[model samples]
Structure formats: structure tokens, C-alpha cells
Target chain A: MNAIIEVQDVSKSYGGVVANKRVSMTVQAGGITGLIGPNGSGKTTLFNSIVGYHPIDSGSIKFEGREISKMPVQSIARLGLIRTFQQTRIYAAMDCTQNMLISLPHRKMKFLDAFSKHGESDHAKAERLLEFVGLYEKRFLNAGSLSFGQQKLLEFAMALMNEPTGLLLDEPTAGINPTLINGLIDRLKRANREFGITLFIIEHNMRVIMNMADKIYCLAHGEMLAQGTPQEIQNDQRVVDAYLGTH
Target chain B: MNTKNIIFYVALLVLTAIAPFLFPDFRTQLATLWLMIVVAMTWDMTGGQMGYNSLGNILFYGTGMYVAAVISIGMVHDVGAYTDAGRLELMTFTERQYFVGAIVGIIGAGLFCSVTAIVVGYVTFGLRGPYFAIGTLGVAIAAGELVSNWGWIGGGQGISLPVYPGNFDVGKLFFYYLFAGTGVVLFMFLKWLYSTRFGAAINAIRDDEEKAEAMGIHTMRYKLTTWAMAAFFVGIVGGISGFQLIHFEPLETAYQTTNLGIFMVVCVLLGGKGTLWGPVIGAILFHFIKEVTWNYFLGWQWVALGALIVVTVVYFQDGVMGWLAHRKPQSPRL
Candidate 1:
């Protein structure tokens, strides 16, 4: 498969501290790509740069061969590259259905279109996605009232509603219950398989990433340390030493 | 609509229709109340819904007054000569001229203010939080000062519009209906708007700007659009106010930064920051208190208002609707 997202020698820093330094990676089309790193290893910074969340210090990031490092976050999103936050950002004041409806890509929506009624299909799809994420029963509830794990699930469902070409998930299962984690993993896989969505996930959960990702990239100290299949990554002495540690 | 809702709305409409006749002596006061409600609701559009608390919305109000006045006068007399304080009282407006000018001028003011909002918002929307508030307030303040010095538009003296062509009582009723009509339409518009995807987009922006952008919302566009819409209604009301007042100075009556400007913000805060009924309820409650204090307290009216604002902020920061929501958490809200 062709590379859907390509990052070349990208580096970013905040004031004196370096977040990412000359990071380079590729995510294949129609594949689950994993980004594994320790805390403050610049995994999120790399995702932010790739998705145009901030201006990078240096390097070219491409989505489907088109340079997007200079584009605004919304413009990048409109190009079908969407990202969820590490802490799960959602319209907490709105209900799950309203949140889902707002997630629809408004490519051709005019100012007056805001006054127009939402289509019935949009509601149906929103409900379908909410159901897919196991939040259908809670669809009528405000997102702020949801538990952390459930909020994360709602965020994931919101991302799916956008119908993006590639989804960059930042720690999707971090706050989730272990029992719900497996179900979320199953839903994520089904989304990839059925919806044909390419996922680039930043996860600290080794077992989940290793079991799910076709290929994994490891980072340490703001630089890439390893890139290989899940099997190869598990045995890599560098990843073992830096991430897993001898203990 | 439910029977209860229909009854409530019908009663409201009937009350509004007969309010001028019911309290003929309070026609001017009722008109001013509608003015307060309009400004407060418009202020909530950005302050409550979109998370941009602009303290300078009065900029549009003042500009609307000027634009409408100019348009009406310019259509008949040379605007410069008409605004010239030295001009003779011999310049008289026919009944036709008065009615035509009022209608066209009010509409022109609304459109003109919308354009100004888009232009001003392009620059101001870049600033976040307090900086945005200060930036917009500075704009309104600066406009007042600038207009005060500009001789072309009557400068510090300000312009005067022709009085309504009919009897004094009839005119009061006309202005009252004008304000009431605008307020009602704005209310209906917001009701519909808040139920749309556009409304959700703005609420998303209010919840979190960066996340909204990443979610594919063109936040700047939405912000500008919402402000312009708000400005449109504000401008229309300002035009009506100009015709009603007959004479207005730049700073005190038109801009009135410390008066109507701040009152709108206080009204929204008193009502609830982001609810449909909050601004309306808040404006009504605030208006009554203000009228009472101004009448009885006299010299200490400002102090009373200040105390009310302080109490509202300190004690009921969430306003009435928020307190109600907290007391009895409602099911999913859009």
C-alpha cells in the first residue's frame, strides 16, 4: 500500500526545550500504524505537526503526497486528516447526537446553511456511530456528564462521523476500563476494516499496539529509535531497553 | 408546539401588541426596555454562545445610529448642510419623507453595521479572552472619540433626525412597535439558529476553540458570521433609537459606553450567559430594577446598579437559568 502520511526530518521545539527533533515516519494507506513513546518523547508533538496543530521548526509533512505543514488545522481537517486529543476534546455542553452532527465535514456549507435543518440521514449516521461506540443509550445525555472512558469513546465516535481518510488517535484507550478496552479495540479494528479508514494511533499500551498495528515506530528523547512489524518491535533490544526497560 | 408553549407565546404576543395601549404613559419606557432586550440578546450571541465576550458591541450601535441618520438626511438634504448646526429651522420634512427615510434608514443601518462587524471582527477575532474584550472596547471608545472630532457628521454635537410625521402619541406607539418587532424577530431567529448545525458549531467553538478547529470547524468564519448577524439587529435598533430620541450626541447618547454598552453585558450576566430566555428575562428584571432605582434612589442610582452588578457577579455568576439547571439537571441539551 502507498504511504498515506509521510513525515520527513520534522523538528519542533517550545522555547528552549525540544519536543521533536528531525522525526521521520510513514503511515501506509489502509493500515493501522502505531506510534509508541515514553512520556514527553514528542509523540504528540509529531502528531500535532502532521495535523497542522502548530507551526513546526523544520521539515515537510505530507498527507496523500500533498504538503500540509503550512495549512491551518481546519484546512488540514477538511483535507480528510483528523486527530483526536490525548485528553479527548469534545463539545461538553452539547449532547452526543449534537456533537456527532457538528462533526460532519462542512465543505460546502454557507453561512445561511447554519439556519437550515439537519438532514435525517445525518441524525441516523450519528446514532449509528454512537451505537457503534456503545454510547447509543447515552446519546441524549450531555457529553460533560459522561465518565472519562465514555468521553473518550464519544470522541472516537465523533471522529468517525467526519468520514476522514486517515484518523490520528492520541492515546485512545488510556483512560478506558480494561474490560471496555477490548471492545474499543474491536470497534477500532472494525472501523478500519469496514470503513476503510487508516489509523495512526499514539498509544502507550504495548499489548494493544503490538496486537493491533501492522507496523510500529518507537521514539525516545525526541528522536525515532525503531520502525518494524509488531513482532520485530517486541524483540528489538533498543525498544526493550528504552521503553520496556530491564525491569 | 405543545399547548402550554403555544399559550405562553400567544399570551406574550398579545401582551406585546397591547403593551403600548395598556400602559400609554409607559410607551417610551417600554420601547427602551425592548431596546435593552435587543442589545442584551445580541451581546449573548458572542459572549455566551461563541465564547467571545466583546465589550464594544456598542460600536455597531453608535455606527448604526450615524449611518441611519446620514442615509435618511442624505436622501433629502445635502448631509453636510443638514447636519450643520447653524442651518435654519426652515428645512422641513414632508410626511412622506419622514416615513420613507425611517424605513430605508433603519434597514440601511442594519446592513451597514453587518459590513462593519465583518471588517472589525477580521482583526479583533485574532485576540482571545481579555485581550479580545479590551481590543473591541478600545475600538468602540476610539470610534466615539473619532466621531466626536469629525465635523462632517455633526462632530461632538451629533445629528438630529426628523420627528415622526404623525401625532405624538401615535409616534410613541410606532417606535414601540418597531422595537418590539425587532426584538421578537431576533428572538425567533435565535431560537431557530440555536437548533441548527451552525449553532452547534458555535457552541463547539465556545467549549474549545483549538479542538473546534481540529474538528474541521472554520472557527474564524463562524465567529465573524455570528458577530455580523448580531451587529445587524443591533444596528437596526440603534437606528430606531436615533429616530425616537430625535437628537443624540456621539459619546453620551449614541456610544454611551458606560451606560447601554456595559448594561448589555450586565443584563446577559444577570440572565444567564448562554440560554435563550436568560437575556430576555435578565433584561426585563434589570430594567425594572433600574427604573425603580433611578426614580427612588435618584442620586444613588449608579451606585445601586453597580451593587446589583457586583451582587450578580459575586453571588449568581451562572444567572437564573444556570442556577435552575444546576438545581435540577436537565436531560441532553443541544
Candidate 2:
């Protein structure tokens, strides 16, 4: 399959601390890719770099073969490369429907268009996405009032509102209950299948990532430790050691 | 559009139209109330709605006052000569010039402040939270100091424009209508603005800037635009105040950071920050309190005002609307 996102030799650091070093990976279009790393292993940093959240120290990031490392976060997002936070970041003061509506790309609209009401199709799509994420009932409530898992679901719906080609989820099910985790995983997979959206997920839960990702890349100490099917990476000594070493 | 809503708005409109005539003795005080409302509501645009609590919005008010005065004077006479303290002869504006100057000057003030907001926001928006607040405050303070030193525009002595070319009471009515007209338009504009997608975008920026940006919002553009719009209204009101006062100095009357500047923030806090009606309600309540304390508690007015602020901050941080919302959960949020 052709790659939707390509990151080559991407390095990022904070002051004297190096978070990611010569990190390289690619996410295939219409596929679920897993990134498994121990805490502080540069998974989030790499996600930030790919989505233009911060400037990378060195390296190249390509979305659909177009250079986007130098672009602003909003411009890169308009190109359909969007990232969610490790801690779900919904517009807390706004209701879930508002959160969804505001997530529509403002790239093509003129400044004056901002004052226009959300169109019928936009509202319909927002409702559909909310239903998809099982947040239809909570759509009218302020997002801040929702529980953490529900907020995550709302955030997921919001991300879907943009119709991103590639979605970078930072631990989508980290704080979610086990019962909800199963539902979230199912929805995520369905999004990939039905919408043909590529997903590059950073997950700490081994069983979940192993079950979801067709191919998994494991990182340790800011470097790629292994790249293989979940079955193969599960047996890799370095990947195993990285988790054990961190613990 | 229900009967109740329609009647309420009609009555409010009638009240606004007759307020100056009804309270002829307190026309000036009523005009100042509109001033407070305009500033507070505009302040809420950036401070409450967008979560960019700026302590320096008075910069626009001061700038608008100067721009309006200069434009008004420059139309009929040399502004520099008119403002020159040593000038021997009095410069006068005919009735046509007076009305024309005021209209053009007020509109010019609004436009000029909009541009200033974008320029100043470019530098200040880079600083977040308290740093942004402090940086803007510095800009206003520096402007005041600079204008005070610059003799071209009256220096620290300030500028005085020709009085309204008509009967005195008529002039009061003229300024009162100007202020009331602006306040009503601003209130209506904000009512519509808060219901738009732009409103959602700004609320998103307020909720979380990073997430808003990551979600494909041009957060900086929204921020700049919101501030510029707010400054435009504030500038217009400031122009009206400049004309009403007939004389204004750079630091005290025009800039007035310690007074009107801080009052706007307190007004927003007293009213509810993000809610549309909160600032307007808060301004009225604060103005009433200020007048009461100044009149009745003369010796302890400052102390009493401080106490009121302390109580508002500590006990009622949500302001009147928020308190009401808490009391009645069914109350609709603006």
C-alpha cells in the first residue's frame, strides 16, 4: 500500500534533553499502524512533529508526499493530518455539537464566512459523527460536564468532523474503562474501514494495540527498536526489554 | 419572537429612547453609564469570550479620543495651532463643520483602533496569559507617557475642542444619544456575533488554544479579529467621550488606566465573563455601586469599593448571571 505519512530521520529535543533521535516511520494509507513505546520514549514528540505541533530539530515529514514540517498546525491540519492530545482536549465550555461544528476546516472560507451559521449538511454530519461515537445523547451538554471517557469520545467525534486522511491518536483508550475501550476500538477500526482514514496510534496498552494494529513499530530510548506484525514484535527481545527496563 | 420576548424588547427600546429626557438632571451620569457598558461589553469580547484577559484595552480608548479630537479639529482648523496653549485667538467650528467633524472623527477612531488592535495583537498575542496582560499594560503606559511628552498633540496639558455649536442642554442630548445609540448597536451586534460560527471559534480558542489550533482553527486570526472588533467599539465610545468632556488629558482623562481601564475588567468579572448580558448587567450594577459609595460613603468610598471587589472575587466569581444560573439551573445560557 502507498504511504500516507512518511517521517524520515526526524529528531526533536527540548533544551539539552533529546526526546526523539533519527526516528523514521511510515503509515500506509487506509491502514491501522501502532506505535508502542515506554513512557517518554518520544512517541508523543514524533506525533507532535508529524502534525506540525512543534518544530523538529532535524528531519523530514511528508504527508501524501508533500513537505509539511514547516507548515503551521492549522495549515497542516487542513491537509488532513490531525493529532489528538494524550489528555482529551475538547472545547470544554462548548457543547459536543459545537465542538464538532468548530472542527470543520476553515481553510477555504473567507474571514466574513465565519459569522455564517453552520449549514444543514454540517449539522447533519456533526449529528452523524456524534452518533458514530455514541455521544448523540450527550451532544447538547457542555463537553466539560462529560466524564473523561465521554470527553474522549467527543474528541474522537470532533476529529472525525474534519474528515482527516490521517489521524494520529495519542493513547485513545488510556484512561477509558475496559468496557468502553472495546467499543472505542471497534469504532476506530470501523472509521479506518468505512472512511478509509489512516490511523497512527500511540498506545501503551499492549493487548489492545496488538489486537488492533496490522503492523506495529516499537521504540526505545528515542530509537526504533523493531518493526513487524504484532506477533513478531511481541516476541522481539529488545521490545520486551524496553518495557521491562522502563518498569 | 414570542409575545413576552417581543414586549420586553419593545419596552427596553422605549426606555432607552426616553432615558435622557426622563432623567434630564442626571443625563451626564446616564451617558457615563452607557460608556461603562460599551467598554465592559467590548472588554468581555476578548477578556471573557476568548480568554485573553487584557488589562490594556484602555489603549484603544485613549487612542480613539486623540484621533477623534485631531480629526475634528484638523477639519476646521490646524490641530497643532488649536491645541497650542500659547495660541492667542480662539478657533471655532461652524455648525456644519461641528456635526461633520464629529461623525467622521468617531468613525475614523473606530477604524484606526481596529488597525492598532491587529498590530498590537501581533506582538502581544505571542505572549500568553499573564505575560500578555502585562505586555499590553506596558504598551498603554508607554503610550500615555509618550503622548504626555509629545507637544504636537497638546502634550501633558491635553487638547480641548470647540464646544458643541448649539444650546447646552441640546448638546447633552446629542452626546447622550450618541452614547446610547452606540451601546444599543454594540449590544445587538454582540447578540448576533455570539450566535455565529465566529463565536464558536472564539469559544474554542478560549477553551483550549492548542487544541483549537490542532483542530484546524487559525487561532491567531480569530484572536486578532476578535480583539480588533472589540477595540473598534471601545474606540467609538472613547471618541464620543472626548467630545462630551470637551477637554481631555493624555494620562488621566484619555488613558485613565487606573480608572476606566481596570473598571472594565471588574465590570466583566462582576457581570459574568463569557455571557453576553453579563457585562452589561455588571456595568449597571458597578456604576450604581460607584455612585452610591461616592455620594453616601464619601470618606470610606474607596475602602467600600475595595470591599465590594473582594466580596465579588471571593464569594461571587461567577458574577450576577452565573449566580442566577446557579440558583435557577433552567435559565438559558447566552
Top-lDDT candidate index: 1
User: Which whole-number lDDT from 0 to 100 does residue B234 have in model 2?
Assistant: 90
Clashing pairs in 1: none
Query: How well does each candidate superpose onto the true structure, as a TM-score?
Result: 0.97, 0.97
Cα lDDT of candidate 1 equals: 0.92
- Per-residue lDDT over A157-214 for candidate 1, one digit per residue giving the tens place of the 0 to 100 score: 9999999999999999998999999998999999999999999999999989987999
Worst 10 residues of 1 chain A by lDDT: A106-115
Q: Which stretches of candidate 1 lie over 4 Å from their true place?
A: A108-112, A244-247, B331-334
Model 1 DockQ reads 0.76
DockQ of 2: 0.83
Clashing pairs in 2: none
